[model samples]
Target: MFPIRDHNPSERTPYVTIGLIFANLVMFLLTMPWGLNAEGLWVYGALYAGAVTQGDMMWGLLTHMFLHAGLMHFAGNMLFLWIFGDNLEDQLGHLPFLGFYLICGLAAAAGQISAEPGSTIPMVGASGAIAGVMGGYLLLFPRARVDVLAIIVIIVKVFTLPAWVMLGVWFALQLMGGYTTPGDSGGVAYWAHSGGFVAGALLTLPVLLRKGGSRFWSRTDGHPPHDPIDYGHRSRVPQIPRR
Candidate 1:
């Protein structure tokens, strides 16, 4: 299941979030086969655990957040960013939000490097940073309604759920994967995801406290500070007659 949209909408336009999405798309185009087709781009841009541990290619900590392994990876990460980024930007402001995103990305790289310092795998993608955005969103608006599309084989369903439930499940899966999967196996960077999430939430704690902490939650009722948008749609599934 993946979130399609959320009921919460930011009062101000999220320019930084839009800029990030555009930057990622541009980077994808530059690295794609039809574009530059430069294999060296991955070597230089993607984070290498060994290189970082050795104090070389330190740029990868930030560069890797803009690179992706494939179209699906790019699309999925961008989608999550789009869904969760705006409200955080609204809350954190433009420049601070950008800083928060980069720092979370760095923390994610560190998490992976700590997990597999000797691994030579090149980790790339904005998943870790966007996972941070999800973490922040969960803390600020846990009761916000998010529309999720669940696909199980031929069965399809769309449902609205609290933000806490969706993000909580996602975070749990990352922890489970991090524990179950070998660190050097080189598939999903589960530790990076988990670390970024925790970092994001921790970073957001100051803002939460500034807003009076529990009182803020009481005032907003764990939702956005404004009225939630209503798309006026409900879940539905089509049926097929058996032959």
Candidate 2:
């Protein structure tokens, strides 16, 4: 299941979110040629991306967040950023949100590296940063309803679930995967995802407290400041004539 949207509304335009999406897309296109050649992939990934064993390029911590392994990887990370980053940017303001993103991403890299410091495989993607946004969203809008598309075999359904349930499941999966999968494995950076999320949630705590914390929760009822939107639908099936 993947989130389609959320009922929460932001007070202002999320310039940072849009800018991040644009940057990620541009980087993805620019890096597409690297995927076609094995040597190119290694050369690019090492020079720009972060690896547990590579300590020469200190900038890799930040650059790696912009690099992606493939098209689907780019799309998935950007989609999460689009869905959750806006509200966070609204809450933290443009500059603060940018700082928060980079910090979480840096933390994510550290987390992954800590999991296997001797591994040489390069880790790339914005998922760790995006996971931070999800963590913040959960803290700010636990009760907010998120529209999700669920597919089971041949059946397709849309369900509106509370943000806590949706994000909790995602976080849980990351934790489970982080523990079960060896960090030396060259694949998903589960530890980064889990670590970034925790950092995001905790980092936003002070902001939430200043907003009144429990009182804020009471006022918004753990949702957005506005009334929830109606996502109901009328059946599309043609009606049969009644006897």
Candidate 3:
């Protein structure tokens, strides 16, 4: 499901979120070439995927969050960040947002490494960290409406769903996938997705609590300060005659 923009709006642009997305894309492009496999494609995950077991390149725990394998990988990640990260930046401010994003990314890498303490495969991409942003979005704006583009077979549908349902389902899938496909050597670090999400949600708790917590939700009616906008359809399915 590709997320559509939220109906709620923020007072300020999510500058830090946009900058981080750009930074990740630029970093991936810069390092992607050097990490290509024999097939002349990028696969150098170790540059960011930590080698924690061997006690080396501890920095990859943080670096890995900015690295990605291909254009699709980078694009998908940045897209999500674009959709959901702004409100978070609005809440956390600039430096705090930067720190929060890094922490989530590093925590994501650490989760994958913990799952495969001795594996040599390098994990790459900003997905896990982005997952954190999604998690944080869930808490900050649970009632905010998200427009999702859903495609199946030859049919496409778009709708605005509650944030809890969208993110909740995504989080559930990660957990199931993590357990079902525990393949450290093969890539697709599901654990990182799972871990980063947990970290992001948990880490942001204190901030949520300080901001009047339940009271904030009560005051705002679980919505952001602005009203949602309707997204015109993105499809043109030909209408059929009445059967």
Number of the top-ranking candidate, with TM-score as the measure? 1
Candidate 1 lDDT by residue in tens digits, 1-243: 999999999989999999999999998988989878876787699999998888999899999999998898999999899999999999999999999999999888888888999889999999999888888999999999999999999999989999999999999999999999976998999989998999999999999999999999999999899999999856687666999
Worst 10 residues of 2 by lDDT: 41-50
TM-score of 3: 0.86
Which digits, one per residue and each the tens of the lDDT, describe model 2 over residues 11-128?
8899999999998777776667753343443345442233435657666777788888787888888988998999899989999999999999987887887787766677789999
Question: After TM-score superposition, what is the CA distance of residue 76 in candidate 3 from its true location, in Å?
Answer: 0.6
Give the better candidate number (1 or 2) by TM-score. 1
Off by over 4 Å in 1: 233-243
Give the least accurate 10-residue stretch of model 1, judged by summed lDDT: 232-241
Model 3 Cα lDDT, one tens digit per residue, 1-243: 778678766678788887888887667756665543232223433433335767777767766677777788888888888888888888888889889988898888778877777777767788888888888888878989988899999989988888999999998988888888856556678888988899889977887898899998898777885666656665688888998
Better of 2 and 3 by lDDT: 2
Ranked candidates (lDDT, high to low): 1, 2, 3
TM, every model = 0.94, 0.88, 0.86
